[model samples]
Target chain A: MPQLALNRLRERGSTERAALDALLDDVLAGTLSTVVDGKPWVVPMLFARQGDRILLHGSTGAGALRHVAAGAPAALAVIAVDALVVGHTTFDSSANYRSAVVHGTLTPLPDRERAEALDALSERILPGRNAEVRPMTRQEQAKTLVMAMPIVDGEFLVKTRSGTASPPDEHTDAWHGVVELRTVALDPAPAPTSTAEEVPRSVLDFAGARVLA
Target chain B: MPQLALNRLRERGSTERAALDALLDDVLAGTLSTVVDGKPWVVPMLFARQGDRILLHGSTGAGALRHVAAGAPAALAVIAVDALVVGHTTFDSSANYRSAVVHGTLTPLPDRERAEALDALSERILPGRNAEVRPMTRQEQAKTLVMAMPIVDGEFLVKTRSGTASPPDEHTDAWHGVVELRTVALDPAPAPTSTAEEVPRSVLDFAGARVLA
Candidate 1:
């Protein structure tokens, strides 16, 4: 498949398919944008990448999801800001981030695949979660809407910025460097209605993986 | 201005203006979406909230920026996931997040206010850096494009989900709770080109404010 060309800031664009997949695997949520009656509409959504297609689940009554179901073209952008770069001047200051945008028309998952798709999304949020909980009831599955968008090569773009600030043109006493940013998962708090006294393995693993060492 | 009605999930919608401002102030970046020749295009952008408007700066040569500058309506979405809420079943699992979507036509800041606007953007990223660094040169200013969108009542929507997962109708021994998430700023790494050996107060302050206590 043809690769989507990066028209601006060509230096930051990456052509490797591995880079695109890596970015998608790292970020959990993104904003889905589409046009509604000639005006742009966008909303934040939680998604998981399943092979070459991204899966999104929501209530069937959701307005944005319903609009996309009606055949509107959509775009999903996932961006993770890694650090804040400080330079000698404000113009040179910027953030280090990994961003990916995928464009496609979403298709509602067939009834036979809806359960598996929901499990894919659940696994992304909390690995090993399906085995720990009960299966989704038929009524629950009916209320949920699952959609997938193909991650075609020509319809996607990935850009990343990393490392320190640009080397200063003229060295001065001003401080210049980068402050790394990371998203950490803190301790779990049990819900009042839960009968479970012990934290599950999935929760423990997620926190262990996400906490700053 | 009239408030834009929430067409779905009204319980998650926030009517308070303060909530909108707070979400914008907390998130340093968001996805900006607009229609380019009837196709949806979106890009992650670094932005800062300045009173009732959000300030965005980019190169004049950026294609997405140029499209918005040509009078297309744009929508900016800022979302921060606060926690992963675990439920008894996959259907009940969800994320806790604070999200705000602002819709408006972005207007490029006039030359007279461009400097001040840039300062505002800078201050948001690094509160005290503007005072420590030299002013932007005219040449640097000429290449940058700064734009602002008004946060009017009818054009914006704020939604948030927080606290624990929903109470289970049937008590189960399975674990249920939330794994809180936070964006943390780590230690600063100085660039090789810097002549200064000591980190500045601004960097220290930013790290102090963002690090998990």
Candidate 2:
């Protein structure tokens, strides 16, 4: 991306957009933050990415949505959860973290582009999801609105950092900090009674694990 | 809670402030989002709770921090990766989710209040960690800046919409959309050959899981 093209993510100063794109792909929704008259407001919302354009939506009367629709400048973002880092250098130095820091403006998408944005948002969370849901009703569709922003090249920066909290180099304590990680699997997918020992590969393929240490 | 207090979270014109508070108590630091110009930025960070004050911090010149200090509205959020719900619903209808949203003005701690904010931020990540490292070096303390926001009751809302995605009413499918979650851990502490099974409870408790998932 060119210099003017990378306007939003200038502080990150990176050459790779793919790294941040992958992180955004795995996460479904994002939390939006903006200042209105000096007071701050945050909202959690769903989103989608089409090439470099990020699509997000809200109900007709959603205050934040309406506020931005009225032309207020707004900020939108997404994040992935990683583990908590508790370091060994200092018993008290433990930090938990993951990837973050990509930004873009929230602009009202045109009606002609609405369907694509919605589809993108749905697919971002669950593949093939649009095919499954009843199509958006005309009235429902009318009540909702979508916005898109390009997250291309220099427009965004993706930062992913990990490691336990470490004591300053000067401190040499006997104990170390810890990063606690916990992983949980779906209740073992029970085999169908008629299947005997045959287990569905889907069950084997999709297991749950939540690790945060 | 009163409607005015809930600010924008009033769907039924009521507040779920209690649940929201509990979520905050256990919310990890990795869930914060910010904005720059028109784009949204997401970042995983360190956090702490001191009474009603929620603390967060980073390199003073970090892109996210710089943006916030410049008077851009910021939000500190805590999302709990909750449960997996399975319905007789198809993969299309199956759904799973977590909960959290915190909106607040992000301001640098005045030079005089820096120590308190940093203390709270460090302790929040690991319960007994505040005093383990060398006391914040004058330079380290100067280099790091903290932001504090009150846990307002009304502006808070805890949303829980999760389960196996199913048809509107009841249409059982042959294969339900069973969700499997995956988390990757960062670096792990080296295990010592000299020691046998004698390990601290914290290390032993989460040993089977990733060291920094």
Candidate that would win on DockQ: 1
Model 1 docking grade: medium
Separate DockQ for every predicted complex: 0.50, 0.23
Once fitted onto the true fold, the runs of candidate 1 whose alpha carbons sit more than 4 angstroms away are A1-8, A211-213, B1-8, B211-213
**CAPRI grade of model 2:** acceptable
Q: Please tell me which predicted candidate would have the highest lDDT against the true structure.
A: 1
| Whole-model lDDT values for every prediction | 0.80, 0.50
* lDDT tens per residue, model 2, A1-213: 010011122353344677666766755445666655555556665555678777766665677666766656555555454544444422234333234445556778787776666656655544554454455545545555677766756656555544444443443433453444444455534313222253234344334323221
Provide the lDDT at B144 for model 1.
76
Clashing pairs in 1: none
